[model samples]
Target: MTLVYFPSHFKRAPAIFFFAFFLFTLGVTHFFGGSVSLLQAGESKAGLPYIVKKGDSLGEIALRYNVSVTAIKKWNKLTGDKIFEGQRLRIEPFPLHSYTVKSGDTLSEIALASNIPVSRLRELNKITGDRIYTGQKLQLVNDRKRTEKPSVHVVEKGESLWDIAKQYDISIAAIKKRNHLKTEVITPGMTLSLKEVPEEKHAKEKTDEEDPELFEYKVRPGDNLSTIAERFDVAVSLLKQLNGLKENRIYPGQTLQLRPTSLDEAVHVVRSGETLSSIAFKYRMNVSDIKRINEIEGSKIVVGQELRLKGAKPNVYIVERGDALWEVAQAYGMRVEELKRLNGLTSDRIYPGQELQLGIAPARPFGTYTVKKGDYLGRIARLHQMSVADLKSMNNMKTALIYPGDQLKVTPFLQQGSEWLKISEINWDDLMGSSGGLKKITLGNGPYYGSRPMARRQNNRRYYESARLSLWNTYKRAQKLQAALDRKIAKMGRLSDCLNGWHIVIDPGHGGLDPGAVVANLDGNGDKVYVVEDEYVYDVALRVYVMLRLHGADVTLTLLSPDHLIRHSDPPVQTFVNEKNEVYNSRAFNRGNSRSHWPKGGRNGNLSRRVAIAENAFKNVPRNRRMLLSFHADIDHSSPNVPLVLYYRNRRTGRPDRASKQFAKAIQPFLGAGTVIRGQNVFVLRNSPADISVMLELRNLAYTDHAWALRFEELRQRDAEKVVRGVVEYVKGKG
Candidate 1:
């Protein structure tokens, strides 16, 4: 080796070299440390396992990670866009392994080298076929080892090969290949190698007969033949054959043969637009069977989820708490007798957590069948080979009434004993008279209570008997009257009867602080006066309320006069004190912000509160006998419009409700000749709990004649009377 000597400043050569080395070392350290710190910060900011902070939204997080909100939701299985602080989210997709094509490398060769299925590789890269090019970067799923050594799974009772694969997050084919098994059958108490096994070595192993190892498992709670087969990675058929079982009946503490059988376990990954029912149809498996194997509590699943397509047997149901045999049969669309026959049930008695074997039968298609013209309940029932009572029970019908274009269930199972009568059995005379032993009280613009008379009398026993008889007589008379009215209405083809015994709820749109469509007008003194929509509608509603009550129709108002107190201030805002002693601005109610303003009963803000009040009244009344009418006055600036009626229709079917349309059409003639009955999906009518709901936009305040009519009490009374006539027609038509 030859050495070169430094000539200039030779005395400090060693010191110079030492200082240069120190500076170089410091620079290297700083550069590497900074790079590491930056990498860690980037990971913390937005990456896998990101800890959510306050004010973090899904959109913000998605933007940070360059991902879509939909992708994030899919990854997290979120049904809605709601997240809370401190919740951790997966901000990044799973890391993909990249493979660069080299010379002499083919797609199949690369996939084999990586020990991944060729189909999987193609799926990951979106490749159509075996086409490839050199130096191409192909994205691949990461094949990282889950564990250092493969873990052994002990066979359990009611376990199947598919179940084992799902538990270990491995494919059924992979498990079968690792165990050197031709079939998916495995018995309980048998130890199986989860790691890959050499085919030659597995072949060399002794057979079950030569080993003579006692392979038996005791059944436990929630164990049935299907579940046991799933737990042991075996087929239910093999278990039955080995145990000499003629049926799917199994009990706890029972011992069964633990031998492997021949069956293939198929795995399927859920995709978008797939439902449990559809999945079951694809696999030719019963929906309940699929649910049982997966231990699913509800019929909800997310995309990209791995599901077991095999090992699900048909007609096996695990009894849930509060489950009755009849209910179970109905849920499966099977008759009670058929269910009993399949299960060999001698009695209707069944307990919670009991497993029943519903033997496989040919699948029957259950769907809606449209009612054609001239079809009656009895006729349809006969066509479907069901009784009228059964048909009514299946369709939840309160009356034996069906109309053309109505979609009715063709093969729906009847619910056991949950039917309610359309009309109540009450004596009108006993309820209205003093001696008949029942008294009624007025509450909230309607009769509320009907109770036994409290007054003491010498003939108390006679009075009680007389009241009972009177009630029965009254019920019979009302039924007869309703039948007669139905026939008359059918013959007349018009509504022209008093709305007696009908329950009606009237909702006046906009009240209190919500002026609603304020229009400037001149008073008698030439001062500007504001004609608010709420005040006019309220006045008209009051008149209608009185008219309906006079005709013996039960009436309820969403907002009473006492609740519509207004204070004329500079801002012209209304205020009210709630039960909690909180003063809330009525303006906030109109804006639907009253909940935040009051914190108590604030949800009853403005329009929503009015809707809730109407719904509550409807609930208090009977279902078919109740109707809701919302009154509103519109201001049209473009053109002069006449009075119009609006009603809601089913959005999915695009068909207006028959009753609501009839009610609207009945009132149209009374409003004017040019009045139009429109189908509108308004908030009140669309969401009302009543069977029939209608909204009346009485007259346009912008028009001269309409404004004059509303301003005069006599004209308003005339409109109210027309409305009463329309309602009477509707009630008569319903009968």
Candidate 2:
């Protein structure tokens, strides 16, 4: 028997292979009788299969197949430099095909013919569009078969109709048609069809143009049902019917429907002492026409009876006291010329109780707008070139509070000329001084006067002088009192005083499954060991918590220990298992009040849990007296060796809270001379419920000095003391 000694590295090879080789050596070759074959170097092409033979190593086989040794090893699953005879190996890379474009062949058609995506075809040939020349050689990669059937996609939060259509490489019109969506508003969790519809089907789809104009009108401060109906050229009854309004009462910013009139009919309410001829004359129609339309037997009409007018009728306004023709025209959102033409008047003249035609007003130029997330009155006003006060007035809003899905009227009636006085140009100081400084005060002798008053009362000049002296003394006393109050406030703002009754929540960043930033170091035995960020921060957090508690602070810790394990009966505890087969305590990760269950457990779940824990801790405490301090360590080698105190500012206002900034500044000195205190929008800081939320990146773990300092208990204790000192200072200096 021929002895075949395999290398030591190949000792872990498959047992079946060794058995087959052993049988082959014993001349029992029936199993591989015709399987063993070889490909010559000049006979094989890339991606073709080749059989191995005796005396052939991976390098030799790769050379024979005109491929790289790495490729050969990868294709055959060879762990080391070893191979067996009769083993089949892939000697080539993926194949490519070159196709000449034929007549009437588009890029999409060609891709479909080869079962490839058009995107892949374009990428292979660097083609920008479908304008491919006939007979042009286009390179095509042999990719996986494309799916011909339609797919379904569930809508996620923050996704719009345009976004979904773009993601699927389809048209928005096709999605709308398939889903039968009348509007572009799609809610989260709604299932949407992503199937590409044919051009013919798209042509038959209902479009926005075919739908009636249905708009939402926001009630302005001075708006009523009559004004809204007149503005949109619809009847007040129609507005009430569409909006389901039982009464004409509407508040500012209240949304109302401005739907099209059904069947092109207008309803008219008969007033007292009104005849059919007079009504017809007011509507600019013949008396017989009105009678026939209303089915009247004679010229008689009942008061408060309803009348239906044929076709469209112009909105009428009963001229009120002090109303002019021009003023009435402007108030109804019409030009003076248009009003006269519609009313067939010879000149601009109007009087009280006279009906004036305000013709169907033109469609509002500024259309209605829906409130979205992060929308406020100030923002909406700025976008539409109006003032917040005007927006509130137009919407009849008593306050600035607006929620998403609330409709607002963007367009307000533009008044002709100056409707209100311009006071910004007036000099207020001059006016106040010229008005003789309001009135003068007089002091009377009372309990402070002694029994020895005997002089006669003085003249007017003496009395005025005495009054001025008394006034001066009162002003001086007021100034002194204010100064005393200022001094008291300053004394109370000290760090110790501030922390005395404050509820401070400390969040130790990363725990359990999340190691945060990690670095490798050598132990005494020269063995590699990992230094985890969460461990160091947790140690520091415990020290800070103890220090704050000693300082009379009501402290709450988000993560109580490194292992995150909590007692079974501990309130508000989240239970989880760590990588070391150890159980730990954590908060149940939740986004909102309703989402209590954890979804897609992993890094995301851990972070959400951390935030939830902090938020819950904060909520149980008083809002005004709460503060959150999150501790973390950085691992950036290139970052400067310094501590960082980060706080969040409102994105809309673009400024951090004054107290938060003061707290950061107070803690900076204790952290070190190189410490940085800045405003940033970190997740924890932004979402924390505390009045003051700040994050402290203790030190750079990657730096040798910082890393070495963290290893020693004494050094970490000293650092924790410094942090406590900073917190004390921040609280004391809160004023």
RMSD of each: 30.8, 35.4
Candidate 1 local distance difference test against the native: 0.48
CA lDDT, candidate 2, residue 576: 15
* Candidate 2: 10-residue stretch with minimal lDDT: 28-37
Q: What does candidate 2's lDDT look like per residue over 579-604, in tens digits?
A: 21111223333122222232212435
How much is 105 displaced in model 2, in angstroms?
Answer: 52
**Over the stretch 283-319, how does candidate 1's per-residue lDDT look in tens digits?**
5568998766554547865432334544334556544
Residue 729's lDDT within candidate 2 is 62
Query: Candidate 2, overall lDDT?
Result: 0.48
